[model samples]
Target chain A: MKFIHTGDWHLGKLVHGIYMTEDQRYLLNQFIEVVAEEQPDAVVIAGDLYDRSVPPTDAVELLDEILFKINVELNIPVVAIAGNHDSAERLSFGSSWYRHNHFYLTGKLIYDFRPVQIKGVNFHLVPYAEPGHVRHLLDDSSVHSHQDAMKAVIGKMEQNLNPNEPNILVGHAFVLGGETCESERTLSVGGSGCVSSDLFAPFSYTALGHLHSPDAIRHDKIKYSGSLMKYSFSEAKQRKTISIIEMNENGSFEIRERTLTPRQDMRELEGHLEELLDPKFYEKQKTDDYLKVTLLDDGSLIDPIGKLRKIYPHVLHLERKIESVDQKQLRNFSSIKEEKKSELDLFEQFYREMTTAEFTDEKRELMAGIVNKVLKEEAQK
Target chain B: MKFIHTGDWHLGKLVHGIYMTEDQRYLLNQFIEVVAEEQPDAVVIAGDLYDRSVPPTDAVELLDEILFKINVELNIPVVAIAGNHDSAERLSFGSSWYRHNHFYLTGKLIYDFRPVQIKGVNFHLVPYAEPGHVRHLLDDSSVHSHQDAMKAVIGKMEQNLNPNEPNILVGHAFVLGGETCESERTLSVGGSGCVSSDLFAPFSYTALGHLHSPDAIRHDKIKYSGSLMKYSFSEAKQRKTISIIEMNENGSFEIRERTLTPRQDMRELEGHLEELLDPKFYEKQKTDDYLKVTLLDDGSLIDPIGKLRKIYPHVLHLERKIESVDQKQLRNFSSIKEEKKSELDLFEQFYREMTTAEFTDEKRELMAGIVNKVLKEEAQK
Candidate 1:
């Protein structure tokens, strides 16, 4: 038995108000090419299939096309789960019909760790879930933490497992041995998300999502295929890959990572404006990559984007830096009398900097009261 | 070629704020049972599979159970389309994958009118579509009205069709020779939502939706099976049915309307509150049916709903009226008002009736201006 493992597509994502739909489409095409070339027996998309609960129309269309190609055209069985970013009900819509075509999609935890048997393999699918969601689903008042809920779920899963056959677990969650990303939803507050990697020792292999690094977790049998693309600046240095796993007759498996080259790579650069503007500066960098340029200018730069984009058409971001001010220089004076200014007057000045609208007399008075209360509390602390 | 034609399910419909989910579930279960009993080559659900685009969780589950039973459990080929009530983009999702299971669902209007070949019959599916959606999909700026857009679409569809085969056109829209309920959406203002029935004459048969009455449209070939259940009071008298269509070797077709009994019946009765509650009422009316009781009381009735439901547990509506309020007396009061009350004062009184909060001075002043403007305009007319 063989299968491809991938997850966290996060289609229709935007970073700092910039739409990444085109870039996402480019990377997803590469994913399709990999699927076509590798031609695995089955595919398992862990979770976080969508970036937001209410995806745009185009995003839905794109996902439809990809799923169609993988499940129908290629005739590969695809099993997917819903993550925190998805509306479980929406994801599970038409899933019953989908099951006939060998596409198993589960969004609810109500099934309580029931394993879906696909071609004699017991696949335990646990979609990304919070402690509260699990507790509500189980209707168990004692389940206060993710670990506790997972334990209960695992217990149920154990009942259905055939110990002789190979058992594979697919989940969309943060394991203990993975680096975190800003886009990945936090499952709990403290130790709730900290699931021990050894919990799945009974399984032949574990496929995971959430962490954006393909190699974030590295147990002999457990692994993370990361995301389909680099979704965050923090993942600029990370390599994106999809895993292809082949199981032998003995229930042992061989796994290999196939690197995906995104249509537009993400790259960050820092230097003076003159050096960056120089044609030689970008000679070493990929011109087609999504660029974030940081300028170490003394003051504000003029038309920085227009100039930089001339050389790099994909320059997505620009940041300017002046000489940093000392932390002590930013502190406020303790006594208003020492500065010969009333607290109300000081509040008026602060209000002007914070808001674009002009403050009225009533608004100024309100601001003064709030500021005084906050300052008094801070002083007491 | 033999197939079942069904439409206007409104799976999660609520009539007059009374939940009919149980009734819908029962009817759909019966529908699947019929499909299994008849064992048609294929099943065509014309449109309006759901009551709303964003259906409740329970509604989704109910729909899933039925679709799964028919398409998956029974191994029947299913083809569905989107209605006016559905979001096309959402419906279109996973359609590509669905094709693998021989379930072809199309939401967008196709310019090329090619029919799907099922058992040597060409199944032409025309989903319910707005003029704007047609225009956008065709990318033809010249397309304006619903009739024009439909004409263009049909013209495109005819090009790919083989008139020799047993061609069946499936559509979900208002057409000539049809009666509609309030539940069916109006296409436009004084617009031709009604297409000429002859447009689909080239096909052996046409299965239509949108109209609620099973006999809303009658033709040798073009027919509307109507909604599965009475979705509105206007459809209370309709005998909900599905068309079982059979195509002979010569490419001609025979159609029959198979009566469908919903899990719960829908009924309306009028009488005094005491009479409705009496054991005599149960002798004639089915207590298991959904009942709309109109209490014919001369004065205000006390707890009319509580009293009526004692016998008719499904009393969905209760209203009291004095038979003495003659239409002649109503006509004497010109403009429906005999009192010399200013429209402003009337509006203020109406506003107070609708809300628990007292109208503030600012709100009262605004309402006064609006009411005065409306009255002055009426006086001018």
Candidate 2:
């Protein structure tokens, strides 16, 4: 049995205040061509079909059109699941009837885990869920983290599995020890998001999402097809690809990589403004690609972005070379369990972000009173 | 072909700042029983399955459950369409596959309107669409108002119809001369939202929604199944019922109404606070029903709402008898093309509503600047 494994399309993504709909459309159009050429028995989109619960209208239309092309036009079966980014209830609409056409889309969790069997292969779809929600659903108090949640869910699923036949687990979670990029870097802010890969030992393979890098995890049996495109500059060097997996009756599989290039590649260019703008240098580069230009000059030039945009039409970002280190430091500070800051501390930070007004004792005291009242209500709840 | 024709469920409705999910659930549970006992050949939900686009999760679950019961469990064909309140794209998810089970859900309007043929009946499902959307779709510039849109849609549909066969047009629109309650009265505030009943003259029956009263139109062949419940205080005198239509092969039909009493009826009580609170007055009334008390006393009373709530746990509204005329005046004034007020006038009214501060000349000048800028943008668009 053979299938294409892909996920984390994030169809309605917006990066650095730029709508990525056109970028996503460019890549997915090519993806459909690949699917048509390969003509796999089935297509497995692990999770994260959308970037957010309430996607834009165009994103909804794009998803509908692409799914119709795959499942109806090409007559290939598609199995999709809702990731944490999706509204499970919205995705599961018309699901009861969808199975008749070999279009399996699972969103919400069910206690009785059943594999969608196609051609003797069992595909267990465990969509991304909060650990607390999973614990309540399963009536298990011991589930405290992503690892514990996945363990309990797979444990019950194991009872209904046939070890003799090949089984695949389609999931969306940060696996332990996986590499991360700046965009998805926030998922493991406190490093509690990842689940251990060892839990899927019973399955022939585990196809996953949420991690933007394809090589986030290195095990041959566990794969991250990676996001459809480079979501951030940190992923500029990463190769975006979908995986084509071939599994035999013996439960052994071989994997091949299929790379899809973005129409406008994301790149970072650092140089002195004068040298960077030289006709010789400008003529040699792919100026149309989305670029982040870093000026090496210590003194700021007038309208650097304006000047850069003339040469590189898609210059999306501009910065002094020295400020790059400050950004990195801020990023590190943000990920240092800083979201768990005290209420007053968080409020002070928010106040600074929202206004140029100074934080005085009078305002601080007023905020403190409100914060205490909220805490009181929280305690009562 | 006998079918249950019902619509305007408004499943996730909230009235008077009170959640109506429980009330809708109570009525719908009985609705399923009616379906089971009657065992209609088909179920045609005209439109408005939900109160609004982006309904709450519970509404989604309830609609899913009810549809599952009818289409999958009871094995009856269910045909539905999107109303004005629905997001067409969201409702049409997995629609291609839903057709295999005879669950026809039409959301978005298309150029070619095809009728779903079931048991010799050709059911034309014309979902509610904006006038501009229909004009753009049909490439006919004449489609301007709700009446024109419906006329153009039905005119195109008429070309594809076989007059000898029983044809039912399932639609969601305010037909001309349809009676409406306070909840849906806003739709025709200026009386432009309604279409003429003559548009459905070609069809054997036109099952409609939007109007909350079943007898909204007097035509024998054109009838409104009405909303699922009394969504407004103005509907207190109206009996809520679901229409079951028994259509024969010869295009003749018999209609029967199945009334479902609300668990807690909505009622209005008028009297002096003291008289209303007396044991004699309280004992005769259904204290548990949702109540709106009108205090007829000339002087104000202390804690009248608190006192009334002791006997009537569900006092949703309280008003002084003298102020009732003011409310009616406001309602009348609002429906008299008030929404088309000048930008500055509308802003002044909004400002008055939001703040106790008076609208001074200085603030008026500041607002005029912003309103003019917005009007400029609107003109450009």
Please, what is the TM-score per model?
0.80, 0.84
Estimate, for each residue in A329-361, the C-alpha lDDT of model 2 and write its tens digit.
Answer: 456446747457788977775564334357789
Candidate 2 local lDDT, residue A287: 88
True contacts kept of each: 0.59, 0.62
Candidate 2 reaches a DockQ of 0.46
User: Model 1: per-residue lDDT, tens digit, B1-381?
Assistant: 789999888877778787777888878888888999999999998888887776666777787778778877899889788887776777788776667778888876655467778889888888888888788877878777767766767777788878777877888888888876788877677755667777877778888777888788878888887888887666778888888888986678777768878776777788877776777766777886777777676645567787666767877766555465555643543343757776666665544433324668999899878877887899999
Candidate 2 lDDT, tens digit per residue, B1-381?
Answer: 899999999888888988788889888888988999999988898888888888888888888888988899989999999998877877877677778899998988887687999889999999989898999999999987889999999988988999999999999998988876678736545756889998899999999988888878889899898889888888877777899988988899999999987889988889888898899989998999988888877544688899999999999999875443346545644674755778797777655533434789999999999999998999999
Best by DockQ: 1
Task: Evaluate every candidate with DockQ and list the scores.
Answer: 0.49, 0.46
How far residue A252's Cα lies from its native spot in candidate 2, in Å, is: 0.9
DockQ of 1: 0.49
